[model samples]
Target: MKLKNILIVVNDIELAKKFYHDLFGLEVLLDSDGNVIMTEGLVLQDEKIWCEFVNKDIVHKNNSIELYFEEKDIEAFVEKLEKLYPKVEYVNHLMTYSWGQKVVRFYDLDGNLIEVRTPL
Candidate 1:
């Protein structure tokens, strides 16, 4: 068995696609109705479709899981994030670990937590 994709529920599929593309350069590989498959095996499913299939309420900012990305220039990434989405809620404003890794955590427009960290 292998992990093929990591799916996340989003309130707005278009906005989620744009968010991932604008920030991390992830392009859509396929768009199947309410489900969109993007580069890096990330899948975006519309909240309505997901809730119907799962028969449960959708939860945002549960803080149970987060999407992580690595960047050599995390500082520039953070700067762009601020410029593009001023209303974005941050989990932290750029912090460096004792091991010299810099990271910043924030919630996307849909309240999906994400962490951008320097490459190890």
Candidate 2:
């Protein structure tokens, strides 16, 4: 079976919304009740990722996921992110990992790790 949308649990929905919006330029396809739907083809499938925010602490703590973006202008992408959300600097800072991928790792407001990388 193919994987559909992935759920990212966060403590603060509004903050997470702003973070992802600034980082990926994602559109809010659906926003009703307490749920928000983000569409950007984050995964290969024709699926829309969902980020559900709850008042409780994250069910899965210290968890991270890496999303490899095929960016033609890496520098510009990084600059745009930095300008919008300075707090994400820790989550999106540039570094070379042992796997030889240049990545920027940082956490959402609720502590979910997010990495944007360019594999070498």
lDDT (10s digit) by residue, model 1, range 34-113:
99999999999999999999999988899999999999998899889999888999999999999999999999998889
Candidate 2 ranges beyond 4 A from true positions: 41-61, 64-70, 89-92, 96-101
Worst-scoring 10-residue span by lDDT in model 1: 78-87
Which prediction has the highest TM-score against the true structure? 1
Itemize residue pairs with steric clashes in candidate 1: none
Off by over 4 Å in 1: none
How many angstroms is residue 70 displaced in model 2 relative to the true structure, after the best TM-score fit? 4.2
lDDT of 1: 0.95
- Candidate 1, residue 59: CA error in Å? 1.3
lDDT of each: 0.95, 0.58
Clashes of each: 0, 2
Cα lDDT of model 2 by residue, 47-84, tens digit:
12232223333343355464445455566767886777
TM-score of 2: 0.65
Q: Judged by lDDT against the true structure, how good is candidate 2?
A: 0.58
